[model samples]
Target chain A: MEKLTIIKVGGKIVEEADTLNQLLDNFSALPGYKLLVHGGGRSATKLAAQLGIESQMVNGRRITDAETLKVVTMVYGGLVNKNIVAGLQAKGVNAIGLTGADLNVIRSVKRPVKDVDYGFVGDVEAVNGEMLASLIHQNIVPVMAPLTHDGKGNMLNTNADTIAGETAKALAKLFDVTLVYCFEKKGVLRDADDDDSVIPVITPELFRQYVVEGVIQGGMIPKLENSFSAVEAGVSRVIITLASAINQDAGTVIKK
Target chain B: MEKLTIIKVGGKIVEEADTLNQLLDNFSALPGYKLLVHGGGRSATKLAAQLGIESQMVNGRRITDAETLKVVTMVYGGLVNKNIVAGLQAKGVNAIGLTGADLNVIRSVKRPVKDVDYGFVGDVEAVNGEMLASLIHQNIVPVMAPLTHDGKGNMLNTNADTIAGETAKALAKLFDVTLVYCFEKKGVLRDADDDDSVIPVITPELFRQYVVEGVIQGGMIPKLENSFSAVEAGVSRVIITLASAINQDAGTVIKK
Candidate 1:
């Protein structure tokens, strides 16, 4: 199997002009048969504020109401995804921007109301790995937006981390997939305030110990869970690091 | 040769909910291989207004300044394009939404300053017919947004009609192509006030006679010019009609 690296970037890395340029520069450089899955949460929130729509959040996750879904669709699928694609194309990468709705790449179920009705939020159901792998085989790099569909004519807001994990797992059968989750931090830091205290690796044993120790809490928890899940599903490795240092391999590597 | 119908619908039909749903229904029913190129000018303008950016137009053509370009990217590439893709998916069309930049499907040069600087507008230079036809061959319908890219990392606002015409021309060699231009009216009206006065078949001689008769003037001239150009480029036919009536064949058909 050939090597395929799936990079999942956050809103901070892609939303600003300077960071985005740097991200594009770094991303275009480190690659062979790579795909990008991106978040546009900050941009979506900003656009929603501009459009006078209030963004609701439960815990730290956004509640994707009807209007919020439209905002995210515009920001993530349209603005951010296309910018990355054009930038990659300028660098001679044949990049295609996509939402899960396009080509039915991913079909997701709208999150059912358990305690909170996350209106238009979708929990991913399936990823069309063959269709996606075909594009990679054609040398067309897909830049995915954090959006999915219910397959019944509705767009749903989905998590970029989950999108990346699901896609990586799906494509793992045909490729030596390395899933990279990029955030603002360098890696999973031993000391949250100290960037240099990067934990080089984390296993299931370490994950539990850290969770109990209050070092692995909040948003980092779900991210780590996704990383672990991907590795278990035949993905070669899962890296957590800063978007700027993707090629450097200076990040937390998750092992089963 | 495989027959392919390329339909171009303006913002009026696609920007509204009811009209868009109707369009997806009728469009899905069109026989054989097909592609859709759409405009989102109204939606873009509305978004621009919401974002506190003013849309500038000279001679009824939008001047896509930096801010306006962002608006169009969000509206045309994101919101309208994805909506169409999702709707078609529900209708079993297996649609994939694309912009010119995607897969390098269309490449355009920025329009040089002739009289006024049309900021980021693109003049269609080439279309990758082989790449696009491959998508269609795989039974995926392409929903194209009215946007292109300069090879230099910039997304340029393009005319939907030109995209359709150019794509139709490019694909003509591999497919028997019929280019359809859908606007608000039924067709090229013989009488401006009478929607029933649609000229069923418009030959060059009749077009010249109508121009002299002052029946066809202003915007309709360029649209007809585009229709004629597509026909001459080996497209089997060009249909000018309403979006709702695409399957009914109740429109002006352009011929040599």
Candidate 2:
């Protein structure tokens, strides 16, 4: 099977001009088949504030109301996604921007109201690996926005990490997929404040040990869980690192 | 040569939910290879007003400053384009939404300041018909937004009609292309006041004669001029009709 790299980038790397360009340079230089999944929460929040729409948050996660959904669609799908595509094109990479709804590549269900109503947020129900593989086979790199649709024509806000993991899992049948989560941090650290305290490799047992040791707490816990899930689902590897370290072999590797 | 239809829809039809759904239904039902180019001037204007940004217009044409360009990028590329893609997907058409920057499908140079600065507006330099043909051959329907990129990583506001016309002319080498300009009017009318005054067929000679007799005046003249140019550029036919008249044969056809 051909090897494919799937990178999920956080909003900070993509929100600014300088970092985005640097990130794109590394991304464009990456060898082999690649797909990019990106988040634009910062930009969306700024735009929403400018438009006088109040953004509601519960437990540090945005409640995607109808208006907030519009803002995210514009920022994540339009501004941020197109800029990345254009930047990659300037570097001689043929990149195509997409939302999950574009080819029905990802269909998600609206998050049902339990104790909290998340408005138009979606939990992905399916990812069309066949369509994605066809695009990859044609040498077209897809830059996907963190948005999905409920097959009935409603677009929903989705998590970028989940998108990358699910997409990697789906494409595992056709390719040896490597899912990378890129953010501001160097990698999972022993000391959260120290940049060089990067753990080289982590297995399922070690991940549990770290959790019990309080080294990997808070948001990183769920992130690792998702990564392990991908590995269990047949994805070959998963990496967590800074955006600039994409080409460098300097990140925490997740192994089954 | 295989036949391809390129439709350019007006902003009004897309702004309203009912008309947009109807338009998407008609568009999805069209046979063979097809592409959609759409305008979102109305949405852009509305968004600008919301963001407290002044929309500058010189003689009814938008003067796209930096701020206005951002609004259009969001509205046209994000809101309008994504909705069309999702709608087509729901109807079982594999549609991919794009701006000119995506895959570098279209490259434009910034319009030099002559009389008006027109801040970030672009005059299209080239369209990559080969790339477009490849996608169409793969049975993927492209839904293009009215935004172009200046090869150096800048997104410029472009006219949707020009995008449609230029794309059709470029694709003429690979396909027998039909360019349709769909608006509120049925066709080129003998009298602007009467909805029933549809002109069946128009030739270059008749177009000039009608202009001399004041039968075709104002905005319609330039529109007809563009239609003639497309015909001259090897487009098999150019149709001017209402959005609902897309599938029907009832519209004015421009012939060489």
Q: What is the docking quality class of candidate 1?
A: high
| lDDT, candidate 1, B123-240, per-residue tens | 9998999999999999999999999998788999998888999999999999999898987789999998998999999999999999999999998998898889888999999998
Candidate 1: Cα lDDT at A246: 93
- Reference-based TM-score of each model: 0.97, 0.98
lDDT digits (tens) for residues A130-179 of candidate 1: 99999999988999999999899999999888899999999999999999
Clash-forming residue pairs, model 1:
none
Residues B1-256, candidate 2, lDDT per residue (tens digit)?
9999999998898889999999999999999999999999999999999989888887666899888888888898899898888888888888999899998999999999989888888899999999999889989999999999998888999999999999999999899999999968899999999989999999998998998999999989889899999999999999999999899998899989
Kept native contacts, as fractions per model, are 0.84, 0.72
- Please list, in the order the candidates appear, how each scores on TM-score for chain B only: 0.97, 0.98
DockQ of each: 0.87, 0.81
lDDT of 2 by residue, A46-72 (tens): 999998889888977789988899899
TM-score of the first chain alone, every candidate: 0.96, 0.98
